[model samples]
Target: MGFWSTLFGGGSPQEKAARIAAKAEARAQREAEELAEKAAKTDGLFERALGKDPENCSYDARQKAAIKLVLANETAKGREAWLSISRDYPNELAHALEQVGVCYHLEKNYRAALENYEAAIRVGADAGHLADNMAEARKGMAAIG
Candidate 1:
């Protein structure tokens, strides 16, 4: 019935395996819940995801929050978060700008999207695939006209 029983008792190996699996699943669930709770404690959604002390949160922390918000379809919020962080972390501006462009593009603000993508490239987010994203924004702008 318990770990001691599973380990020391004469239970079948299958039962022991199942118990171990259930315990592992429970532990994973508990850890996930704890992380979610920690992310929920801040004021706004972005802040909450970042933590209560965003000012002290690292660049990676802010980046993770932004990415999570975007993936969750809170793109506008994610863009805002990225923009806010970029001001303080100019070195990360290129990546943040690219994300902002993506948000604007999704919202059909094609011109803003194109501008941001261009800015991202200019600021050294100049990876080859970034060009593809910029081209998509350009296509969107053209389609609008």
Candidate 2:
């Protein structure tokens, strides 16, 4: 049933449809305002899940921001996150070493990209994806320059 028909249909025929419409409109307005308020909230104040372990968490505000940035596909922000965490976390450092290659690749810096990719491998990244990435960077270096 239509919204108005559900609430106002059962009412007396004398019930003005205008009043029901006004009430619905007011309710919609209130809900919209509530959504807007929630959207305005700053996520900077919250810590999300831990990557390695749920109990292992990021207490650093910058790291938290970087996570949000990575989630949001902000590559520059992702790079910043890598920069901040690589210094502290060995795993993150290895990952960041790979990301350095990625950043260089994005900028078309083939030599730099290859160097970082190799460094990531040297740093103990044996992941198949890393191998594939290194190969791709090598191909790019050969083709582009």
Candidate 3:
């Protein structure tokens, strides 16, 4: 009966299910390709901003690159860049700590986020600017607990 129905131009139930599954597979493949392309573009931009030797790059250039990476949703790379800055330029430690906290917050690691935020405050980052971020991390921690 299903074969006869299919021959008559009405797809059988199995055929309809297969068609839906094929469409879903195709959509998933396209989405994966798009994500890969986006990641490649972000890497290119990060390299351009930071240059080949990021360690030797000017502080401003490294900071710009780190900011770009973070804004592009590459939080781990951004955090590393910020850490390098803090290590090489002690004067910028407070700001770098705060940015690292933000990256941790974005990653949903609330405990790490809070710790970095506190360290930033201790290092003289403006408390007023960090207050909102600290509160949000605390809220997230509370929700989890």
Model 1, position 143, has a per-residue lDDT of 88
Weakest ten-residue segment in model 3 by summed lDDT = 47-56
lDDT of 1 by residue, 53-122 (tens): 5574788777787777877777788788888888878898998899999888888888888899889888
Residues 29-125 of candidate 2 have per-residue lDDT tens digits of: 9999987764443233122222333454453544565555555545554565566567657666666778767766666677877788888878886
lDDT of each: 0.79, 0.64, 0.86
RMSD of each: 8.4, 8.5, 5.0
The superposed Cα distance between candidate 3 and the true structure at residue 125, in angstroms, equals 0.8
Give candidate 2 misplaced runs (Cα > 4 Å): 1-77
Candidate 2 to native Cα RMSD, angstroms: 8.5
Candidate 3 local lDDT, 1-81, one digit each (tens): 588776764676898889889999999999999999988877765664444454647888778878888998899988888
Candidate 1 lDDT score relative to the true structure: 0.79
Best by TM-score: 3
Candidate 3: clashing pairs of residues = none
Give the winner by TM-score: 1 or 3: 3
Model 1 segments beyond 4 Å from truth? Answer: 1-45, 48-56
Candidates arranged by TM-score, highest first: 3, 1, 2
